[model samples]
Target: MAEPRLGQMNASFGEGSVVLRWWEWGPADGLPVVCVHGLTRNGRDFDVLARDLAARGRRVLCVDVPGRGVSGWLPRPELYAVPVYAQCLAPLVAALGRHDWVGTSMGGLIGMAMAALPHATMRRFVVNDIGPFVPAAAIGRIQAYMAGAPTEFADAAALEAYLRRVHAPFGALSDAEWAHLARHSARVAPDGRTVLHYDPAIGGPMMAGDPADIELWPLWEAASARPTLVLRGEASDLLLPETAVRMAARVRVETIPGCGHAPALMEASQVALVADFLS
Candidate 1:
């Protein structure tokens, strides 16, 4: 069979619009599986996973969420939360009819909120290395890096090296994979400088929100009607092991070792686990 072709969709949100880019593969009429990446990452983060799911006879749609990747930046950064994301994603899902979902970090949170919504479009849900009750210490760590930082990298390689230092937990991705990630995550400037692809101000809403003194169990429980699987990195600081166990009460939980806050499910073995769950 020929290599699966990729398709892009533009979801209108106001006059500016929010582009919904996706990669499609496998049979034309196969089950749809939508993959969502983390806060700073793009839909291409699931290139490997998309291929794996495609090969397994699933139509994978890896979305470049608003404010990340090729997608346009949200003019209202204040609407950066999952609820706002779901508002945009709802139409995309409707266009696809119905589809399963896999999300990491912020993406996972988005999927959870969608599943909770009445008359949701999600068929099944898989959360990669994130949970409802995130630890404050881990939140602090993420906030430190997301705060706009100066980058003097001359090219993509220099920027990749810097990314490797900050996101070391993404695991040892191959050169080609790392190259792919860096290409989507960074852009070369006119003056020989490298910068992250999306607007750093996109993080404003995230940081501006007051700390939640309450638990997010209510949000997580809303998706109880669906078959949900939560994957946690054993070394993840964001979702503490105790909290992961607690989330298990809501759905099946699995722990992947030798990983940190988020585990890049780029490996074939990792993708197999997701395939098995979606099956």
Candidate 2:
């Protein structure tokens, strides 16, 4: 199917001085579905899923959370916590007028917080590969990659190489898919070197201990007012299959085999599963 009908708009947070970017697509008034990306990943991570959902008649709201994608780097990366992001997203959702949410990794955590707030707007919640209490081993693995990634590259080819090495979850992409990812991940710097699109500090908060043994259940439990969908990668170390199954609250759960951390949700079967769940 074709990509979704798309457009961009600036979403303001912390006054007019700091404006983040937001993207909207599909029917302007269709049921809204907010698709959030992972920590290191930007909103484009949801492109495949967004287009699919829109094609099936849903408006998709994908965003560049502070330091990623076309969005600008934060003046202070420490402000990279979910609380800051949720504050920014509240207005964006209000502007949307209506919607549901589908978050992946970091995005999932943010959605959980939104669902838990006193008067949340989340019509439905779909968390892809994350839980209230992530495994320490998984956090370690993600930090290792996020700690120091190449910001400069000789060409898009080199950038694609990094994505393949680091984001193996996409696993054996076609040439075009590789190119698509590279184009979204890098910028042709003024000096001609390719640079990553997000702030390096994006890994900051994730590395900080949240001061709790398990911090997700309260938020997940708050989602009781809305139906929830949790997707897990069967072989994912970041989100252990057993833990994901256990997080299965008063909601639905599914797992994709042969994938880790995330399922691309690009294939027809995966799309069918998500679409059916949302419906």
Candidate 3:
């Protein structure tokens, strides 16, 4: 299939004037859908899924949350919290008028907060591989990896290999998919080393906070009033089976088998599921 038309825009926030970058796909007048990526990940992670939705006549906006992707890094890394992300995204949400939201991991948390806003513009919500209650063990696992991640790699192949190992829990992505991920996930440093694209200091706030299980049940409850779908990886350590069961009471829950932590949602089946729900 032909590649979808892609466009980029920037929105500035805060006194220091941080710029948040986002990519747009499909027709300008098509039904809108906003997508947000997880921590340590940028907006490009939604390329496959966003393209599919765009082809189906939906306008897709994939945001590179502050400190990630090509977006400008914050002057103070301590502001890298979900509340800050949600606040920064408020203008974009308002400008969209009304739209559907697809959030992965940390993005899901931001979606919950946004959906709870008094004037929230989000109509339907799709949270990928996360829940209202994130276990401390899962948080620790992510923190450990982020803390020890290599700053530089020998080359593109080395970076791809590193991504394949660390993100193995993203499930069985094909060779091309992995290559696409690595291509957008890193950039060439002045020294010619392949470095991860995001600001490493993005982890400062997370590490500084207490290592307790993140509890946002209140936000989830408020957001649950809207049409919502929660996708969980069958072997996911973050959104446990019990949590999924509880979430099923308020919103639809679907388990993506053969993965842990999260489902990449690049597969036809996964994309179709999300598209169908939004339709």
Candidate 4:
């Protein structure tokens, strides 16, 4: 099969004066499929899936959330919460016209909020490895990781090692895949040290928030106007099986066996499921 067309990287200002970056692919006027990444992740996380969808003639857009990837860092770290994230996304979704959304983790939460709005423009929604109720244990794990995340690496090898250790939940990615991830995840500083792409302070708000007090069941329930699909990793601690079952009551649910916190849609079968559902 021919590879999908990759569009030039584009930038636009978002909430809090942050500049958001995104890449477009496939047809210029095809149905839009906005792909959002997880907390601490960038738009490049969706490259594999985006290319797959684009090859099928969908206009796929993968964006970097504020304070992450190539997007501008927030002036105040307190603005890193979901409400702000959702607000930042609203304009982007509006600009794209009616579309589909595929979000992972924090991105899923933002999508849920947007889809629940009284005048949502989403035609279909997919939540990947996240739900209304996020387990405290998962939150704790994420908090610990973000708190102590490495800022500098001596070389590419070191960065790869760190990513493999921290992102193992993404499951058995190949060395080439890891290289692709590392390419977008790190940037060399003026002093020649390689650092992760996102602002380290982005974790400030997350560390201060009590996970138990963060509830979004109302948003999830209100977003039921459109057909939804929930993708869960069978062993995900973030999206509990029970919670997935509850969400399944109103939407389609697909569990990827042998996976952990998230299913990286790098595999053909996984991409096929997402493409088919969006179509």
Candidate 5:
């Protein structure tokens, strides 16, 4: 069978007029499902899951959040906050009429904020490997890595190796999957060196924040009132077992085994879990 036709579009948001680029799949008239990627990752992270959903007759829209992928970087790095992303995405969600949301990490936080809105058009939500409460340790870990990240790599092999080390928490991805990730996660610099696709300046606002736990319980409480599913990596340092237990009281929580911080959702089982939920 032929692969689903992939298309792209751009939307300008915020006073800075940052351009947000997104990928689309499946028939235009199909049920809409929006997939948002994690911090430092682009919409291409959802290619596997999106293709499956598209084949199932669902319209899948995967976003390249500002500063990542083909999306334009923020005029000010401070605009990298979740609230800013939520604000930028609100119009797109509203335009979809009614839709389902699937977000990973920072994307999940953005979804929470959007879902909490007074008249949110989101029908169902799937939050992947992140919660309202983010521990300071996790924040520190991310900051340390970002601070130490190499600006460029000698070749694709070097970049892929780096990605494997940092994103090993994304569960057991196959060789081809890792290659796919590397291909989308990086670009060739003018100097002919491979570099990460996201803007390095994004780390400025991220590190400027206090080195304390991030609390977004209010957003969680409001968003959880709607139908929500939380996917937690069994060994995630970010989403502790206790936290997932607490979240279970308000929404369904599924623990994906063998992963640390997040599940890639590229596996057949992982894709099925999400597809079944949205259905």
Candidate 6:
């Protein structure tokens, strides 16, 4: 019933090194479940889901992808692409030996890439509110917002309000849940104004690339070998319903009603869906 323990693992990427900060819960030798957060989010986002799974005797590991949260920002910001993210996961996955994966948004994309690899170790794959074929509209929205996000907030209260307004698509999160999210997503700046936890330059790649040029159908097809599950928001502009249907032709698809863009997976019901899938 205690909160998850915190730790960091190092992953080498060429000459530069990246440290993946993670939160661990449950027994040390329990079944491993790696939970990855979305873009602009940190490992703390999985606190609720990790707690639920850990309570059930699963060793849940939630990671803050490089460039986000407490993880060090990559010196070469160009390495912030999906391929690099997938590469970074290689060592962690190998270390786990055998594990299941639950990823949200950008994290889900990373899972898809990992699944496409020749030596995928994931026993069950759950992609939360994302698919290989993301609509350009969704990418545009993300690009526009991240490209010019305000770095300073008057105070923690102001930051929380801003997060609630921008991330309303995460569905109806309680005030406490929102507060937890804001606390993790923000930190005190050198000038003392609260700012988002991630490096602002992390948005550069997205802003520079055209969504039309990004394709992942081959990766999706490559993932057909696994028992994959796709969680889509009913009103999501990111993962189209058609794409979900196509994915369902080879895997399982679950639509979270009244949700759009993404589901935070913080609620008990949402956590239950993942628990059942991975169980």
**Cα-based RMSD of candidate 4:** 2.4
Residue 262, candidate 4: C-alpha displacement in angstroms: 1.1
lDDT of 4 by residue, 208-278 (tens): 86654355788889985699989999889999988989999999999987678788888778888998999
Ordered by TM-score, highest first, the candidates read 6, 3, 5, 4, 1, 2
| lDDT (Cα atoms) of all candidates against the true structure | 0.78, 0.76, 0.88, 0.83, 0.87, 0.86
Q: Report the Cα lDDT for residue 172, model 5.
A: 91
TM-score each candidate.
Answer: 0.91, 0.90, 0.96, 0.93, 0.95, 0.96
lDDT-wise, the better of 1 and 5 is 5
Report backbone clashes per prediction. 0, 1, 0, 0, 0, 0
| Candidate 1 global CA lDDT score | 0.78
Candidate 5, 3-28: lDDT as tens digits: 44444444445575666678888889
Error of 5 at 27 (Å): 0.8
Q: How many backbone clashes does candidate 6 have?
A: 0
Per-residue C-alpha lDDT of model 3 across residues 1-279, encoded as one tens digit per residue: 455454444544555456778878888898899999999898888888888888899999999998888887887878888888887888788888899999999889999999999978889999999999999888888888998899998888999999999999999999999999999998877888789999888986778765678778888999888999999999999999999999999999999998887899898899999999998
Estimate the lDDT of model 2.
0.76
TM-score, cand. 4 vs. native:
0.93
lDDT of 3 at 99: 97
Model 5: residues with Cα > 4 Å off, grouped in runs:
1-13
| Superior candidate under lDDT, 1 versus 3 | 3
Relative to the unseen true structure, what is the C-alpha lDDT of residue 15 in candidate 1, on a scale of 0 to 100? 46
The runs of at least 3 residues in candidate 6 whose Cα sits more than 4 Å from the true structure, single-residue gaps closed, are none
Q: Give residue 104's lDDT in candidate 3 (0 to 100).
A: 94
- Candidate 5 Cα deviation (angstroms), residue 33: 0.6
